[model samples]
Target: MSVSEREKSYEWQVEDARAGQRVDKFVTAQGEWSRSLVQSWIAEKRVTVNARAVKANYRLQRGDRVALRVPPPEHLAVTPEEIPLDIVYEDADIVVVNKPRGMVVHPAPGHHTGTLVHALLAHCGNLSTINGVYRPGIVHRIDKDTSGLLVAAKNDSAHASLASQLSAHTVERSYTAIVHGDMGHERGTVDAPIGRNPNQRQEMAVVRKNGKRAVTHFVVREKFKGYTLVDCRLETGRTHQIRVHMAFIGHPLVGDPKYGPKKNRFSIQGQALHARTLGFTHPRTGEEMTFEAPLPQDMVDILNRLRRESGL
Candidate 1:
């Protein structure tokens, strides 16, 4: 491989849930590459497990570190669209947007356009390339059905700083969610580890072994007959962390399709969750910053209806 391709190397530590899975399958599950491509890389001895080149069918063991030196991408086009963005804050270093529900943060399979990244390309023109061409300037992501405040870096320095803050667990991120069961207590914390569900590769779950540490502190803001509005603060960000943690505690978000019950009472799409608050330090100025976004109309309407039904 070329030096530039070597510089693009990626690594992932195998968790307990992924133990015994084929190396090619494990690498392909990352969503960045295809199985055939991964197999080709393995044949070329570009993929390694624990510093040793492995075959495509090599079964990964817990704690094994997998590394792959990927070739350059094949002209994946991400066209800039004229989609409107709800700008909450903007400066030379960063742009904060209030992304509405149903709008994807970045492009992926089956969601090529109408994404926040496409809109940002048109609005800002220049963004940090740290996350590569597909997710330029994106530091973090909320699910497609989630609405909230998210920041994007305009330059590499800004992206590095924001990413460091997130890794250090210093960024302040809080969300509002309506859960299915009424909470018996006013506040509590769910401290668990999250990892990919072994049975269902596409889903995340609270796992007892080899999972990354995830903590969520929540307080009941309001309660209805069978639901509770709660505030959730994330200590460590994981994919589907809040949804998985809430469901682990037996109070999954009202409209959550993956983690919650199959049937839902609310007509809203996806989870009844909104990222309401975000705080971080400015990369250039070393200044503290925070932003808040109100709940979307659909969530507000549901709360209002719940209050009326409960006579509260």
Candidate 2:
């Protein structure tokens, strides 16, 4: 791999140690840029593997050459709007938020405003930039249709700590979801590799090759004749772990638009999934903490109806 003599161009020849790592991750580790920045660079076609364009999630192999052409930074601005936020916990280092359903974590191509980031910006004025400008303070994310708990880093150190915990799979996350089928097993684990859906560009699918390892452990919390309430614990945070895994196992969530049926008896806006609990070690004090968010009104109301109908 060679660097251009004039501009801010960088290249790397992948080694054994770097093999199997995401290209964006490997490049970011070589420099001080945030993952979001690297991902943006990758998305803008500024990065390439062996002269071929690759997605950010592309896994590198030994002997692969990666090159990055840096253009002068074009500041992508995100305005802070006066959106109401549900602040669950806050301190000097972190902000724990109970995100409502329909609220996005950050700005994306189609979703550029009215996000949790905007609310956080209005509430705190500053957030950790490790995830870059669009995703300040965001340590992790929940789908726009899934409501529940998320933690944001107010500073860089906290962001690093939280990110490390996630990488190590030490952070605990739990979700409550209503699925369409009655699971045969009371508890089970879905260990599969998840990659971008080949058929649908906007979806994820389980693939034997070119997919990241994902594991989800779930327990049947309650059961009805045709539905089940499951508690899911993720071993890896893929884009759509619970939703995809459940659908893969023939038990899609009640109102999932992407992975489930077109119509359901429940007239909910989106998926019947909620991030109910989150646990992690305090970045500052080294103390362990766990937080739980009560089921939202829609979930509560649906459960009530299910109980009444099923006589449970």
Candidate 2 deviant stretches above 4 angstroms: 1-36, 39-76
| Reference-based TM-score, model 1 | 0.79
All candidates: TM-score: 0.79, 0.83
Highest TM-score, which number? 2
Find the 10 residues in a row with the least total lDDT in model 2.
1-10
In model 1, pairs of residues that clash are none
Give the residue spans of candidate 1 off by over 4 A.
Answer: 1-76
Q: Model 1: per-residue lDDT, tens digit, 1-312?
A: 665544477899999999999999888776434355579889999899999998998999999999988767444367889998899999999999999989999999999889999999999988886566788888899999889999999887898788778868999999999998889999999999999999899999988876889999999999999999999999999999999999999999888889989997777998999999999999999999999999999899899999999998
Per-residue CA lDDT of model 2 for 161-243, tens digit only, reads 89878878999999999999789999999999999998897999998878999999999999987889999999999999899
78 Cα displacement, candidate 2 (Å): 1.4
For residue 189, give model 2's deviation from the true position in Å. Answer: 0.3
